[model samples]
Target chain A: MQLSPSLTQLIEALRCQPGIGPKSAQRIAFHLLERDRQGGKQLGQALTKAMTVVGHCQSCRTFTEQAQCDICASTKRQDSGLLCVVESPTDVLAIEQTGQYQGVYFVLMGHLSPIDGIGPKEIGLDILENKLQQGGINEVILATNPSVEGETTAHFIAELCHKYQVNASRIAHGIPVGGELDLVDGMTLMHAFTGRRTVSQL
Target chain B: MQLSPSLTQLIEALRCQPGIGPKSAQRIAFHLLERDRQGGKQLGQALTKAMTVVGHCQSCRTFTEQAQCDICASTKRQDSGLLCVVESPTDVLAIEQTGQYQGVYFVLMGHLSPIDGIGPKEIGLDILENKLQQGGINEVILATNPSVEGETTAHFIAELCHKYQVNASRIAHGIPVGGELDLVDGMTLMHAFTGRRTVSQL
Candidate 1:
């Protein structure tokens, strides 16, 4: 059966979300029509308000409605002359969830993938360089994912940092929490064995 | 970290969509804040437009922006003597995808369930009764799922149709096409064997 043009368009637009396929989109659209008018209105308002008002913090590149995000604006956080760089705002959230990192973040939006035509300019390497030049960031933590493109991006960023006279280090690669050796991927297993620290030495 | 009241509220409001877990919701909210301004605007416009415009077709109880949805409005659809009854708009779409069924549909929106508090009135059973009384419908196909609740709903509707002197039939339950008999659940196997058709007149 033919749906209303607007309804069809709404489903099409909702398809952009990562896991929402055509069937799921239709189900969501129908559910929106059937059950939750209030939810629909709230969703609309939230989407519009957030996209219009929220922006990147000038210093840390974290999202903020002001000139700087709360972390960047606060005087209380220990600066530590360190900056932790990540791939996306989602990755920023993941790191923040750890509660271990005290430094600020610089989100690259995506890793550089030359094969996919994604380059330094596409992923905002220039922005990182500019931020580094603004001073006080002595150490850079390259926390990109442990994929090929991520590794390439990290190495490129490290070389760039060295040229700018800044110290940079790639985050450790190993088996994740609760991971068994048999279940871990080959690269991670190799990394874990190679980077193993002796308890007796410690 | 504590978010602003408005930001927190907006994030909370985005929880209505299916498959959007708390972390995913937070990530999406952050993505809208960091980038995707145009996407957010389009999403809002699409949502609000669909919600304000789409409603149930008066006759079939399916979603539509018009007084009657396309299926109900089409003179070409075989409205002759058969009506397929289904649980929701999703079911309507599922039935339509077959291209085999020529009849129009009557959407119940829900099934009969007392524990969860869904009842006949909630699903507009009386409306179906009224339509049955108006006649011209020779067969009513109960196309609800094979779940216990669906069976209960079908039985209830079938009884009502019988009271109105109308023919009612439930869709057969059996092993699905390409299903392995060894892997089939015991109950389904029993149903499949019992509902098996006679291939030879031996």
Candidate 2:
């Protein structure tokens, strides 16, 4: 039987998420109808509540329920003149999961993909510049993913940081541990050789 | 940075769906926060709308916006005095996709799993029996899956149909076309051999 228009629409909307194909979407659609009516209600409520209540932090651009996100507002974090920059709130979450980063984050909201018409203004590079001018950040770590677009975006930010007389460095990329010689690609193999560290002889 | 309480809660709630692992759920959570704000809002609206607007059809037991589902209410469909009973809406979708059947359906919504404490009343089998009795269905097609639980449930329903004096038949089972002998399990292979069709010699 045909599903109700609202459920059909909901399933359609759900399909926009990554990896949610039509069949999976339909399964989830029917599942919501079949079991956990309260969860279905909660899904609706949470979506609405999050969209309306949560917004990007003005300072770091991370998602916040109030004027600023918890990280940006926190007193415990080392404002120790360090800030890690990333492309999205999910990236922020990924970094947070590591539990190694005590410094704050600056979310670009997106990268500098000029071909797609995405530029500095679109990704809020101006905000990063403004935050730099405000002082206190001694080191800016370019934690964007190691892709062509990400590298180009990082270079653009690094150049801007140099212009403002602020120290900046991109996150490192090299051969992974336990990588075999035969499995390594040409460029990575060359880079790994060049960047190899000296080992103490027995 | 840690997500806000609402976002954290949203991701937690989205975990109930099949195949949505933590990472996928997190991605969807942040994706809703980043892009498609309107889509997110619409999803919530749709969920609430579907939950409040649609309910189970009394006759067929399919979830419907109206008292009777569209399939059951349709005048175009042939009411061939036969009813096909299946476990869930997913099963209904599967049967509809085949496009081979002309008659309508009766959704059990779930199977009788006594170990899980699911009984006739729990899955509304009693309601289905009443509908079948009132409609005077000449035949009842048991279209449940071939799983042990499904077969057991089908047989239980078949016994009830026989008691009511309604003709009941199980859907056929055999090796699917394009299926390889090596991959075919013993039970299916046996069925395929037993139910082999006669062909004219070339």
The best candidate by lDDT is 2
lDDT string, candidate 2, A48-103, tens digits: 99888888788888888788888888766645678898988878877888888888
Candidate 2 positional error at B189, Å: 2.4
lDDT score of residue B201 within candidate 1? 75
Backbone clash pairs for candidate 2 read: A81-A138
Which residue runs of candidate 1 sit more than 4 Å off their true CA positions? A111-134, A146-165, A177-186, A189-202, B2-11, B26-35, B114-118, B193-202
Model 1 chain A lDDT-worst window of ten? A71-80
lDDT of 1 by residue, A21-112 (tens): 88778777877777887798788878878777766667666666788777766665536777888888778767878899888778787889
TM-score of chain A of each: 0.87, 0.87
lDDT per residue (tens digit) for residues B17-95 in model 2: 7778888888787888788788889888988888788788887888888888888886655357778989887788788
CA-lDDT, candidates in order: 0.82, 0.83
- Summing lDDT over every window of 10 consecutive residues in candidate 2 chain B, give the lowest-scoring window: B73-82
Candidate number of the best DockQ: 2
Give the distance in Å from residue A137's predicted Cα in candidate 2 to where it truly belongs.
2.3
